[model samples]
Target: MEINGVEIKDTYAEGFGIKVTRILVTAATEELAKIAATEATGYGTSVIGCPAEAGIDCFVPAEHTPDGRPGYAIMICQGGKKALDHELMERIGMCVLTAPTTAAFNLLESEDTLKTGNKLKFFGDGFEKECFIDGRKVHSIPIMSGDFLVESEFGYKDGVAGGNFFILAKDQMTGVKAAQAAVEAISKIESVITPFPGGMVASGSKVGSNKYSKFLNASTNEKMCVTLKDEVESDIRADADGVFEIVIDGVDEESVRSAMKSGIEAACAVDGVLEISAGNFDGKLGAYIINLHELF
Candidate 1:
């Protein structure tokens, strides 16, 4: 199948079931809110080596925010409950608490709970105070700057991760441009995040290492390597000189599919993009299989 003359590979992107939490970081302005959200979600791309995968969902205007300020929503994901909890605690404590004029709140609205401010409040050394805002418990912890307002609990729920697709181009520059366009498109979608640096991955990986090493859990995806076209059973085309990937984690299958569709369409609209493909583990990796064909 082809979308806008860009070939859609006859394959599916494998996904995984993971625990997710949505956090809202609000600030006096959108800029500060973005800084806090970006910081909190930094270094969180793949769960392979990182503790979690996170990305900015979108911007929330002052009228929509809890504190009547600009805010940014981000989703943090981990393999399990404990891991997700740990990620939230570390990220919120270090990132949000340190940002100027910023406050954190729960955005998921799920019954399942994760301790966010409740854990970070201790940073106040018993001087922390509590209050109720619109029926939700919020804590104000004193800091060197003043006080940091944080929601007591963060919402937690099961989410889908590892939703990804590859952009094959005739050259590296073209591939990068296409990937950027795709990322921009996906960023507009809600309840999902690209996670990776600049929302693009130049070094994609496969399931396991070819040379089994104690330090390496996964190795490079040789099939997507243009240089290895003649070296291994490559999936790269003869004319393809570059390959970049965009991986997404969403609150649900629908959100993932929606983002993927927008990304693929945007990528296909770019010039020099030869084809669009996805990474899958023969349907063994996870229960969700986002078929690229079905998307179009």
Candidate 2:
């Protein structure tokens, strides 16, 4: 398939199942809310080495927030319930709770609930008080500035992870530019996280190693490397000089598909972008496979 004269390869992106939760961080102003949200999501790009994958979903105006203050919606993705709970406690306690005039609230309306500030209320040293805001249970913890408000529980749901695509270009600079455009486009999307540094992954990996240890978790995709085109079994064209990938984790298949489609469209509109493709470990690695050709 061709989009704006850019070739779309007949490949699919592999995605696995994960757990996702949404947290709303509110403050006196939008700037403060964003500061807390950005700090909470720091160092949370990919699960490869990070504890959790997270990103800012969007900014919520004061009217839409629980505390009648500006807020930001953030999503955190993890492998299981225990991991998600641990990550949320650590992130919110250290980041959002410490920020000035900041408060955290659970945005999910599901019947299922996970302990959020319920565990952190101990910092109040037996002085914490239970309160109700808009009929929702909230814990007011005493702090230096004033009372720190946090929700007792948060909501979580099953999600699809590891939705990825590749951008092959004529040169490294060209590939980087395409990836930047793709990231910018996907950043506006809701319920999805790119899970990589600046929303781009230069070290695309395959399942295992061709040599060395058999127990290796992952190895480089030499076939897609422009420098190793002649030495390895390559999928890169003779004119292609570099390739970069974008991996997305979303609440569902539809969200992931929408993110991928928008990202691909933005990347294809750039010059020197040769082809758009995706990464997949056959049909065995993930729960869902998003086909690139069918995205448009």
Candidate 3:
């Protein structure tokens, strides 16, 4: 199939079930809130190496925020519950708590809970106190910047991760432009986050290593490598010179599917976009299969 003259490859993105939690970081101003959110989500592009996969989900207005201040909603995802809990304490304690005029709150409601604030409140020693913000229970931990409030019990739920698509272009510059357009379009969708830098991955990886099988879990995707096109069995179109992969994580499978479709359409609208494909391990690595052709 084709979209705007761009070929839609008959492949699917392999996605797996994971744990997800959304936190709201509010501050005196929008800029401050963004800083806290950015810091908390930093170095969280992929779960392969990073302890967590996180990104800013959306911005919340003052009226909607618990402290009547502007805030950014961020999602932190992990492959398991313990990892998510550990990452929540580390990120929120080190990043959000350190930020000026910032407070963290739970943005999602789920039956499963993580004692995030309970663990971090110890930073206050004996001075920590239980408090309520906007009718929600929280921990008021005194800090040099007055007090840092964090939700007592952060809610967590199962989420979908690794939903991705690749944009094949005539050159690196064109691939970047198309990927940027796709990321911008995906940003409009709610309950989804693209954790990569600028929401695109230039170095796509395949499962396992050809040589260092014990030390390396993955290696460069040679099929997407223009230089290795002739040497390796290439997946890129004959005219394509570069490829960019955009990976998406969402609250559920439907949101991931929607983001993939939206990103694909946006990429196809860009000039020199040769094809849209996806990464997968023959549907063995994940529970969800997001077919690129089915998206259209």
The RMSD of every model to the true structure, in order and in angstroms, is 1.1, 1.5, 1.0
Whichever of 1 and 2 has more lDDT, that candidate is 1
lDDT of 2 by residue, 27-103 (tens): 98899999999999988876766899998878889988888999999989999999999999999999998999999
Q: Pick the candidate with the highest lDDT.
A: 3
For candidate 1, give the lDDT of residue 167: 96
Over 246-282, each residue of candidate 1 has an lDDT whose tens digit, in order, gives: 9999999999999999999999999899999999989
Q: TM-score ranking from best to worst?
A: 3, 1, 2
Candidate 3 residue runs with Cα over 4 Å from true position:
none
Where does model 1 exceed 4 Å of error?
A: 213-215
Worst 10 residues of 1 by lDDT: 206-215
Residue 264, candidate 2: Cα error in Å is: 0.6
lDDT for model 1 comes to 0.92
Tell me how many residue pairs clash in candidate 3. Answer: 0
Candidate 2 weakest ten by summed lDDT: 208-217
**Per-residue accuracy of model 3 over 41-150 as CA lDDT, tens digit each:** 99999888888899998899999988999999999999999999999999999999999999999988999999999889999999999988778989999999899999
